[model samples]
Target: MTNHIIVTIGRQFGSGGHEIGNKLAERLDIPLYDRNLVNMAAEQMKISPDAAEEVDETGLSRFLAYYASAPVDYSSYYMTNIEMGQPLSEQLYQVQSEIIKRLAGRSSCVIVGRCADSLLADEPNLINVFITASKEDRVKRIVEKYGLTERKAAERIKKIDRERRYYYELHTGKDWGSIESHDMLLNVSAMGIDGAVDALEALYKAKK
Candidate 1:
């Protein structure tokens, strides 16, 4: 409804997906919605942004052990014996979808992750992209960027990828990272972020 070119980026873990999304927004002079969405959702839900961010991107419930494992008490501390009943990840997904829809309607912005590609599937002017890289490249990048040990970096990357894929599959019932879901699928390890953005801009202009 806003008539702005919406870009949704899906990426492999540690592939610089968020950075590329940010850079693209800066170049286009458009708003970028990424972790800010998590923050907003967190504020709305009265939860920590850290908590929201953990469950923000990727396949649903697959990383429950790693990301969404909220602390609970089963001991005498539970005098009420009533679970606070935290919002399910699916419910959070719905909230995020609504937030994205509202944001897109008001402005042309780049949204990264959080099932945005599928959520905006009906929009005529949306460009969905999937970014990926070789596991080796991702591992190296993670190590250097996060100053993590090789083993830790590899574990982190793999865990994040799994969670993302699980989330996508759970929410959309479509395989994550499938080429069909995206209008453009680029390997940043091959072209770099700027090159990818350039190619995307060209594609959008041509489509327009």
Candidate 2:
């Protein structure tokens, strides 16, 4: 394994990104960070993990303002001494940012999404990857995994990709899932999930 490796995977919905990350982490014998980041960040923020998870993907509209420094009690549920009026998404981003940096500093790990590639852009030995798939394959995967009709699956994928694009662009100012944003890009519909992981693992070793 490459020393001090940090592989960040930005993926399209139903592209098997999480599965790829998990396999890569296992093969590298390192921990994987995915939706669990929400819990970790929520814990640091002294809030319920469920609360953070709600805004993790789709984002929050009810709460506005990310002024952690201002400390105004605009809403009781959203106010802690340092969290008053803070936007849920941004607040979560700040905490997760700290955690991501700490994890990267500690040792090798695989991180999935949450704008991690951009967050750790300055870190050493980091491999930023974008995973994409054909729309037909993605829709089929979504339909099978979630028991949705093909049309609903397609719609969900669009909604999810839109949310991901908005979130990633909002924080990183880089085009989400663009060639410029990543060191490597893989089409899982072409290579398959395990095949993508295999290719990425080889790339990770060469990154040294």
Best by TM-score: 2
Error of 1 at 10 (Å): 0.3
Task: Report model 2's TM-score to 2 decimal places.
Answer: 0.86
Candidate 1 colliding pairs: 58-164, 59-163, 59-164, 59-166, 59-167, 59-168, 60-166, 60-167
**lDDT, each prediction:** 0.76, 0.81
TM-score for model 1?
0.83
Q: Across residues 1-208, which tens digit of lDDT does each residue of candidate 1 receive? A: 5577889999998788888898888887889998788778767766655555555664222333334365532222112213645444544567778999999888778898888988888888999999998889999998887677789778888877888888888888877898877777899889987888888777667765
